[model samples]
Target: MPAPKKPASKKASVRKSTKPQPDQKVLIAKDSLSHSEHFKTFLGWVQDKMNENLIHLQTPQVIESTNRHFMVSGKIEAYDEIWDEWAKFVDN
Candidate 1:
C-alpha cells in the first residue's frame, strides 16, 4: 500500500507600505487679519503695553478680528500673568 502525502504549508503574505501616495493632497490652516481698524488699534495698544512692562512678549500678529472680538498669536514668557493683565485691560 502507498503512504498518504502531507499537505504543503502556505507562505505568509507581505504587508503593504503605509507611505502616502504622490497624488495625495495635504491641507494646512493659516491665520489672517480681518482688517478691522478697531482691532488693529487694540493690538497696537497691547503691544505698547507689553513693551512698557518689559515682559519679553513677542509681537502679537492678528489671526482674526471683529468689532467685538479678536484672536492673536505670539511667543511669550509668563503667559498667564500677562493674559490676566490683558483680560483686565479689555474689561475696563
Candidate 2:
C-alpha cells in the first residue's frame, strides 16, 4: 500500500533571489507617471529633470503641498518650483 501525499500549503512559497538588485536610478527612470496624483510622480519627475537623466534611486518624502502638488527640498535654493512634472512626462 502507498502512503498519501500531504496537501499543499495555502500560502505559496516565495523564493528570495540572490541576484543583485536593479539599479535604483535606472528603476526610477523606468517608472511611469500615475497622473491620478501621488508622491511617486514627484520621484519620476525629478529623475526626468536631472539633465534629462536619472539622478536618484530612492526619492525623498513629501514635506508639504500647495495648490495640490508635491514638494521636496530644493537643490540650489530654499525650495524648487513645485509642480507635477511627471504628469507631463508620462506617455499620453
Candidate 3:
C-alpha cells in the first residue's frame, strides 16, 4: 500500500521475419493415378536433374522423400528447370 502499482503493458512484440527465403520445392502426397505417383516420379526427376546441375553449381543439393511427402533443397531455379524437363533427364 506504499506505492501505487503501474499498469502492465499487454502488447506483445511481433518481429518481421528477416530470414532468407528457402530455395527449394516441396510436395505432399494427396491422391490417385491422377496420382501422387507421377508427382513422386517428377520429384525424383528433379533430384536427378539437380545432382547433374550441381556438378558445376556452387551450392549442393539435397533430396528427401517419404510415402507421404517429398522435398528437394538447393537453388529453386534447378527445380524449375526440371519442371521444364520432367519427361527426360537434363544433359548437364
Candidate 4:
C-alpha cells in the first residue's frame, strides 16, 4: 500500500461582521400589527369588520364522468374478451 498524505497546518478565513443583522420579517409583522389596529379603529373597532371587508375567497372543484367501458389494459385476457356482449346490452 502507498504511504498516507499529511494534513495541511495553516487555514485562511474571511472577516466576520460585528453588527447584528436586522430581521425584516419581524419588523414587517410589527408594522402590520400597528396598521391593522388603526384599520380596526377606522372600521368601527368590531369583529364584524370581517363581514364588511370585501375579500374574495377562491375554491376548486373537479368532476369526471366515464362510460361503462372495460379498461382491460392490465389484465391477462385479451381486450376484446374482457367485456362480454351481454354486459354491453345491460349498460345501454
Winning candidate number (lDDT): 3
Q: TM-scores of all models?
A: 0.27, 0.18, 0.29, 0.19
How many pairs in model 4 have backbone atoms within 3 A of each other, for residues 3 or more apart or on separate chains, i.e. clashes? 0
Instruction: State residue 22's C-alpha deviation in candidate 4, in Å.
Output: 1.6
Candidate 3 Cα lDDT to native:
0.50
Candidates' C-alpha lDDT: 0.43, 0.44, 0.50, 0.37
Best-to-worst ranking by lDDT: 3, 2, 1, 4
Best by TM-score: 3
Error of 1 at 62 (Å): 31
Better of 2 and 4 by lDDT: 2
Better of 2 and 4 by TM-score: 4
Mark the regions of model 4 whose C-alpha exceeds 4 Å error after superposition: 1-16, 38-92
Candidate 2, residues 45-71: lDDT per residue as tens digits? 654564321233133322234311222
lDDT of 1 by residue, 13-40 (tens): 9999899654322211111222345645
Q: Give the clashing pairs for model 1.
A: none
What TM-score does prediction 1 earn? 0.27
Candidate 4: lDDT of 48? Answer: 34
RMSD of each: 15.6, 14.9, 15.0, 24.5
* lDDT string, candidate 3, 1-92, tens digits: 59988999899899989997644332221223124465667667777776765553432332223311223224547577656654332222
Q: On a 0 to 100 scale, what is the lDDT of residue 52 in model 3?
A: 63
